[model samples]
Target: MPVPCIILASPRLRKTRWPRLVVVALFFVTNCMWAKGPAPATRIPLDPLGFQPPLAQFMLAGSSMLTVDYVDSDHLLLTYSTKKLLKRLSDCPPADQDRVVDGVLLELPSGKVLARTSWRTHDHGQYLWNLGRGRFMLRIRNTLTTFAPMVNLAKGDAFAQRPFIRTERRIGGVLLSPDADLMILETMDPRPSDQVLGDQPREEDKPVQINFFRLISLNGADIDVHASGALRSRVTGRIPANSAGYIAILDDGRQHWSFDFRSYGGKIKELAAFDSTCRPSPMLVSRSEFIAFGCHLSHTPQILGAFNLRGEEMWEQTMTENYVSPSFSYAPGSGRFAMSRVLTRSSLVDSDSFSPDMFGGQEITVYQTDSGRQLLHVDAAPIARAGQNFSLSPDGLSLAVVRSDALEVYRLPELTKEERKAVQMAEASAPQIDGDPSMVLSSGNGDSTGSPERSDPSTPPAGTREQPAPAAADASSSSASVAGSTPTPPAPVADAGPKAEAQTSSTSASQQAPAEQKPSDIQGDATPDQPRRPPTLYAPGEKHGNDPAHRDDPR
Candidate 1:
């Protein structure tokens, strides 16, 4: 059954099914509005569980949080904890600790708690996975369980708990494929005497510990990872998680970079060596494309762009010094993805600079995964747990973000041709990356070489994305083009300063690839609150890019 588009919040509202004619008319009208321009976000009241709502502030370690996620487009799961102050003998009153943990299944707009139940511990968030369509897989302690609260709440206790595989080994982390067809369980145990190599003299070279990757098949039709069972005997470390259902062994080696991937129900295949300096991040790999962020280009704008699954640069864009890719949300169905930026307030100085290994973004921007068309730009209050405060629907039609006192629901609009053009052109011009694309850096080393040069938003870009023959066109062309995409050159991006390009190839694994696409850059609309980054000495086209960078670049 299709979820109703009703936004009325009255609890007494009755369910009314619209006739087919009315439904069609409503759809037509809504789309017409979207055709004109992206619609403003709809505001809805939010109900955090506790009085002192811990929605945005749950980031501190040992601090309680109110976690919220969508059960379906119209339903939400709000889990939170409450604590009581035990009578103190002395002066110390223990802080409000998360003592009683519980969850409420909320129906949006109406703000009704359909079902109420207790929840497992709030820690070890990695042990939980949203399996899509209201189902979730979670491992509490040594036991793993799967349940769907949306449908099962009416029949039994906290949805019917179906027991899955349980392992004795300590579960270190759990990851699900992008398609949610399989789960990779990383388990760890101490090094045993039998496994230890007594022949090795070096302590580091000897087996420090043992880690194993156990695969569980979530969907039988897709990759049969369980058939292979536990990967090898004892993995030296955690296996690379490929959400696109391509379980891979990445060799992020210094020179002659290469990696191997196993197709769904097929043999492992190796990719060609990458000579380019850009080392792609494997975090959000799809069957079609991957991302490369500042792999060593310090002088140029820190780049964030997509590439072919086999390691060809498709289209790229640059970001300001403060922009960080902390949270990533991709909708496999709609081919739209979102990334966030975070600015931390530090007591060390009055102004907040970008921090490493942090999760919080001042804005959450959504774009077409393939064409790189900028779809939606939203200003979000920085939350340490920014990942939880917002969610993109699986089908990619709607985006719900947690606001201070309300939930801002934004309907992702399908832009008309003119709108797509305006968005791309308004985003950024083609980026001019000079020098040899090849860069050398130590493994996990902080950067590729370049001076710390920041872009000024007030300046117009070098080029724009054109109508056709697009795949991130070179700046030399009036309209930058990417292969299998139309050219849409960039304009000055507000928050990002100077506009740049970000794009993808049309050849996605599951869907028929588009012939060509014009992509939008990571440039989201700037906000007044965000400080404009100061420009550095080394601008683009300067040789000897090896000069020390300004402190502004977020590594």
Candidate 2:
């Protein structure tokens, strides 16, 4: 607010006007003192729920961040950096040629390992929870280590047998979901080809063959096999690629298959046949979505995929490519789905973005499930690209993105005029300070306007005397010529130390006050009974957006 201009003149003694003049003078003094109540310090506005603190970056042993799993709410089972593990097991060369060292299971914070399982090198791990035997499988050297669930370290291993049961024959990917009394294990094993006839190798290899999917009850009961008996391999394989197939068990014990081509005559059902000879990556089945990896035929190859929840091939979208691979996370309540892509590259800019020869970049795509419309796409800025991940507010109106080693937040576009007004009002009501009104009434150097009444310097009133203004109010005030919109800069000071400190303190206080205020406080007042509610959480492994109907432009 602009400081109120004050004109302090000698108290006139006209009989009728005396009382009115005294009242006006008193009111001005009180208002001026209140207005000058110590200028507030400067502050920085920050989002409450929409801010992400940086996680300590530890370029772990392998080329990727250790895949983390929630053991419960308080603890996480992480395949963290294993240089130490590798150092200790240097003598134990990988039996299967996988470089990933069996990581020591360490309790977070304490960093105490309850047990150590044999290691292998792979990209991910899956936790298998059975009522009778709760275990997790870590895929490194193509070995499956089934260990007791470790929620608390102090409890020790629930039943320690090398901390896990090691499996052989190379299970590239595994999904364990039980239905009724049955527990199904679907592992992707690439098909082998035997005929190397003429120059038709590429065409021969292009034929889509189904991978082996095993259905065994955790309780070891009945076995139901489908298609042409069990799985067989053709011998013309060149590259070491895993088969692409996904298995999902609905609540009613109805098994859904996306890539089980045998049952569907080796044709495209929910899953599509390869666009090229390269075998597709293993399918990922999250709660309500199914995502199958797609391939690109370029130098710096790109990873693509399709998503579907209803297991219908009619609606599927070919997602934008990324450097590494795409992973899906959904908040059903907010009706927003996030496709997180990890960029293993050190550079932020896409190779192709600069040079046509270089054709790879990293990005995270967030889409609105209801409309299947992309809400935002954030490039993985190089500075903090490795560990930085995006987190969203519960309402989905704001997104918290961490990149470039700096935190950035963006408010979602408003859906209604009322919401826009509220946002504007909040910004306008932000705390602000103005210069002291008393400055306008003072003499050339801030001294009292009434110079005719000068008191002795030694016997000044209880408080210090004010300084006079710069010059006579008339000449300076008229020539000042204040601009209409642009603000007047503060008058320069001698030291600038105390003034700067005061400003800083005021800003800090204002910012801190808002920060301390909880989101609930603001939420209660503006709560609206929105008609359509979004989903709160999504199953991690289910494929989403695989249905062609969900795609903006079906391909």
Candidate 3:
């Protein structure tokens, strides 16, 4: 009461009070803004870490294009032709069309050229197969000859070449074992009696001959080839690690034949035969298992089965609707399998060929290798090119899909501790060779171990000398170095929580069943009662249908 009676308010006092109030207000506003932080970035930058750079820019004059492969976490294998002899065959003679070419193994993320070799071939290389442990096989052909040259990837030396069984016949198909130690070649034999009926010759009338060969040694000086007799049906794939031999789908002049392979003792044993009303797709072989997709002639569901080396059906999944040519990747050590199929509104004009623009979109389904349980299912954009268009990384931790303009990278669902341990142990115990490891070409400081100290702008010269290094130890060291040097991934977005939970839920549902459960307990049991979901499809130039759902998905 006494203080109120004074009522003394001077102009200075009033001005000071307003100034203090304004300052307090300004401080509160500043603190609020700071606490909220800058608005999060709308999109993450396309960091080069754990991704392949756009390689089209690297193409040189007269060069076709670069074909890229994720060799491992640390390296990328790139093969490309500097000249196109076949394309200009009419103008340039075969002799004049001598193609100058090589393969480059590059360190990832940094895109540093690690190793380059001119040992590929002067002839056209039709295919490249990665045989684990720094080795690759190139199928090369020219006007006169077709042969497969095995290259010691570490040495960058295509030391051995196994020519086709018959020079006259064209190669129908080539399949390599997981380790690339064995090869299966198929050739088409056109019978004289089967005359050309139309513009396109009758494929069924022409019989296919098969041959199996083993690469005994891959020395630059001496190479040995162990060839087997021709089989009736086409040789589909090799039985992984079964130096005993290769697998073939028999063609006994019938609609269905036994799935068999030549034993190491050179004897054919039947795995399982298809029914008369059913036809099977090409067989996919892993180290210990083989899988094939089969469909009945009637309106029945398609069947996908995984079989052991002993020919026992481990598990099966049924596809209710038809799908266009799908891609599959399997990781044996981790027991993970991924299947990608294209969906369309109407039937595909051609099921054998994948037309990226024709399909609506594609769906990738990840499943347990043994249980056939679906781990994760997501939609993806259409592919960019043909042939091994989809790749699962060696560790089964990432999947690289080649889209039209970019290589889209996706993170696979995480593996359980046991699964990861199993993969690591398998890799650790894998067979490794002793003695001088092949030299590598690096842009870094070099001593004669194939590491080039380059000062020129041109491609580094091929390594000439072989250096003494433990193969396994070198691989381990390089991997560790690259991993440590790789750039850190971008910080996670604030909204990643719910999406991650969804992935976890899906993964958990897949792993709910025991991994070692019998085939009967898991086969066709995971989603037997669920309503059929519309097939995920990808078509070129068209926007993906379910954008919001997959916008936050892992990639």
Candidate 4:
């Protein structure tokens, strides 16, 4: 059965003379208004699970989460976030886990943190896959380097990094292809010195550059750098510091690009660069065509755009409201792309930049890829928000959105016209074998043997009686019924007339001959009684010895 919807209606307020009475009534109504939707499929944690309730069910610890990928049909990979705690302790607490504070690649099934090689600093994370050899291979990148790591969660197992020749100045985006043969990494202004700074460093001049890309092969560890002509930026030589561009991998394995304007259009030279986190996901369309979308913090207004592979402009899709720290994914079977938009409003007193305000927007918008039209929009205000990233199901039927506290699975409706047609065709062609058939049994008038009439809810109910039909009864009365059915031999002929007596005896003897030749048809070892033949009837004059009924009565 489908889950039932929960709706709570507000109660009416009556005019009262007593202030205490009114207060009490209002309080009662307020508590009742706390009704919520059904519990989510499961409860995976945003951080640790000890003091935290299942993030999917309730909002006690201020969490909102969504589904990512399914472990099977029941379990899921959920991405969630909450208010960061200011307190830290040197010694580990009993409930809280002592996580290794380093850039590491970890798998979900087993909590294994990969070791780093040569103190490689990580600014961005890419794809992760379990090699089925108790190790996980992940793609990590920084402004200057991109590398792959084979991490063994087990203590003794060694984690190794395989470096490829082509390194990006800025490795902003990473996508692992479905086939696991190739990965796409987006590159821009590469800062090789971000990781080289000591405890105290000297100031350096800002660099100006355009954005380009590279596609790396996991099988051969080869890189295909984008053509020189592909280097283009929304801002010519120097894009605003807060501005960002994204890369997407379509289902067909094609790569695409887009620009985000979170940093461009303000009095501030940079869009609060540190707090700004923009991670873009590549949804592969085919081997060649894909869609990539992200938010850009710019000196001007922020916007979302899509770039096709042939270097053609498809469309610039943007939200009406201001949103930053955007994450997106293309769902599997659904054919709809979902975007998680985190809206941050700046304080009136602080015009410096966009920061966390009392009121903001967190929404999941799904769009049709074919025409790029909006399909569904869901927003959870005050309760949930998402930042950084989110994931889609393998089949693309559902989307897992990250909330401030937990994850939420937005089950997209079947929207494709073709899919709807197919569903309709299947349902129309399905056999209705239980429906009425001509000449079949009908349950009425004491003789029909069909289904019962529809129950009348208005009528008083009583026990129902069932009886055999006339046709069935007639079929059971005669042995001729066996003629068309199985054949049973007639009992031995009794006192055959003299003219046919010899022929009849010959026939009986002939039948007995075959029976005698066939070693008792019963399989396995037979019981002693099975070997014996029937007793013979006595002749009228031969019955004299122990016949009590005849001896006592003189007939």
Off by over 4 Å in 2: 1-65, 85-135, 140-142, 148-154, 158-168, 171-229, 234-324, 328-338, 342-361, 366-370, 373-555
Model 1 alpha-carbon drift over 4 Å, by segment: 1-41, 47-51, 55-64, 84-98, 122-127, 156-158, 190-227, 231-278, 299-301, 310-312, 323-325, 344-361, 415-555
Any idea what lDDT model 4 has?
0.30
Tell me, by TM-score, which candidate is best.
1
Q: Give the Cα lDDT of each candidate.
A: 0.40, 0.29, 0.39, 0.30
**Whole-model lDDT for model 3 versus the true structure?**
0.39
Candidate 1 lDDT tens digits, 311-406? 445456655545422455666555566766554443121113323334334667776755666667665543533244577777677777766666
TM-score to native of every candidate shown:
0.53, 0.34, 0.48, 0.37
Question: What's the best-to-worst order under lDDT?
Answer: 1, 3, 4, 2
Question: Can you write out model 3's per-residue Cα lDDT over 223-308, one digit (the tens) per residue?
Answer: 23344322322111112223443344433324554455433332334466544243343344455456665555642226777765
Report the alpha-carbon TM-score of model 4 versus the true structure.
0.37
Q: In model 3, which runs have C-alpha deviations exceeding 4 angstroms? A: 1-67, 78-104, 113-126, 142-168, 189-207, 216-224, 232-242, 245-277, 280-284, 296-301, 309-312, 351-357, 373-385, 413-555
lDDT of 4 at 143: 25
Q: lDDT of model 2 at residue 435?
A: 20
Candidate 1: what lDDT? 0.40
Which is the winner by TM-score between candidate 1 and candidate 4?
1
Q: Model 2 misses residue 301 by how many Å?
A: 11
lDDT per residue (tens digit) for residues 489-510 in model 4: 1211112223245445444442
Clashes of 4: 54
Candidate 4: where is the Cα deviation over 4 Å?
1-39, 47-319, 332-334, 344-353, 371-386, 414-555
